[model samples]
Target: MKDTLLDLQDIQKSYDATPVLAGVSVTLSAGETLALTGESGSGKSTLLHLAGGLDQPDAGRVLLHGQDIGQMDDTARAEARRLHIGLIFQQFNLVPSLTVGSNIALQARLAGRHDAAFCTTLGHRLGLSDLTTRYPEQLSGGQQQRVAIARALAPKPALILADEPTGNLDEDTGDAVLSLLLDLVSETGAGLLMVTHSPRLAGRLSRRIHLSRGALAAA
Candidate 1:
């Protein structure tokens, strides 16, 4: 294992006192690709939410690199997600009003880290070069997902979190997209913690762990 980039120590989350996660913990290493597998409602999403700094754990701590994410306020957490973490979701969630190009560049512009060359390279690699001027509504499901992925990768984040990134696509399209995503992730050497239900997809990762009834165990 490499140096730990993200760490969850005794993480616990509850919704209306229904425990979603109980004593969940893991140390995500740099350049590692970890697959999180589980049935529905197994607290996989909750773990991702907490690890990505998208939500707070009711109890315990989250560390990004060496900084305690649980220690940061909302504003700091948002910044953490922006500058250091890349997140992909089941839904593409592109801004309907913005062009694909603009959506891809949005984060970089806000962080004042816009590198035109890098963005262009990402777009080309993601098969979005021709679709750059088009809006999300104009693209197909696969294209939209690709755009979302490009947006996430544009920032060159240290860590990436993907929640069923290929769930909405057909098998072929999903494979292609996943291929692009893994290739890009490998190139950047960013640690990846992906939530997936597909055994085929999970098999490609460096490590595999399954969640059952809110508990994670290596498979």
Candidate 2:
């Protein structure tokens, strides 16, 4: 049987009395890629935040590898995020002061799992080896996003949460970057939960769920 990597059970969230996610539930397994899609106000990003331990659900449980992350203390939650989860954002949040190599190795180093050889391999695979010493400002949008992907995969985390990872690029660049992200995720055998507005992009994943009316529906 496939190992369950993340489980969201009846998740509920609110922002200052406005409900965002209402009793939404989902599960992702190891090496699986799941696309999350919805309208602008449908709570897709809220669900992703909850899943990544960046925010807590007002009700229900978030289990990572069968452990209830919601029950963990703040420090524990941060540790859990660092050690078991990798996040890629639409903005490509690479550190401006760090070189490509440092940016890629940052999370792994924080998680105490830095592997020099593996990081080198990732750089080569991402077509970033030649640019490792370059800063984020020196690269184009596509190259920057590639660095973000390399950083996320460096830790070999159990799950990867990507929110509109290709949103900043042109269509062709976005497609190519998305394909590379998927291939790298598959190579690492980590579960992927991606939020995207494009159905074309969503269709590339193994499975997809749509959020609407603050709840989940089949895509």
Candidate 3:
């Protein structure tokens, strides 16, 4: 059996008495892809944040590779997160002053896992090879999103958490970006848990789960 890369057990979270997640449990194994789907107000993003160690659960454990990072100290948790999880977001948060190549290599360099050959391969695969010298302001929305994906993967993390990664792109562009992400993730055997509003996009993953009112509605 493949090793479980993420395990969220009975996860519960709240914001000023507003419960965002209630007894949520899920797992993502290495080389698997899981899509999270829900309405706008649902807790899909909250769950993703917890999984990525950006937030702690109120009443349960968030484990990465069987270690409960929520129990660690702040610095330890951050380091564990940096070493184990790669995050992609809707904003494509590339540094404004950095060129495409530097943006793609940023995360890997921080994690002390920079690999020039791998980064080059990722840039080529994501169609950013020729755009490496350009700054973020010079690229289109789809190109910026591709840069985000390459940055996240450069560290070779065991788990990937993507929150509306292609949300800013048009339908066709979103589909193409998602395909590239899935293809590279599959090739690297990294577990992917992505939040997506489009059912069509969610259906492409190996597994799907739906959240409603802070709890899982379907799995």
Q: Please write out the lDDT profile of model 2 over residues 111-134, one tens digit for every residue.
A: 999999999988987678999999
lDDT tens readout by residue for model 1, 87-195: 9987787899999999999877776789889999989877789998999999988888888888888888889899998887788877887787678668877899999
lDDT of 3 by residue, 145-172 (tens): 8899899989999899999988877787
User: Model 2 scores what on Cα lDDT?
Assistant: 0.90
Pick by TM-score: which candidate is best? 1
TM-score of each: 0.94, 0.92, 0.94
> Model 3, residue 89: what's the lDDT?
80
Model 1 Cα displacement at 65 (Å)? 1.0
Winner on TM-score (2 vs 3): 3
How much is 168 displaced in model 2, in angstroms? 1.8
Worst 10 residues of 3 by lDDT: 168-177
| Candidate 1 wrong stretches, greater than 4 Å | none
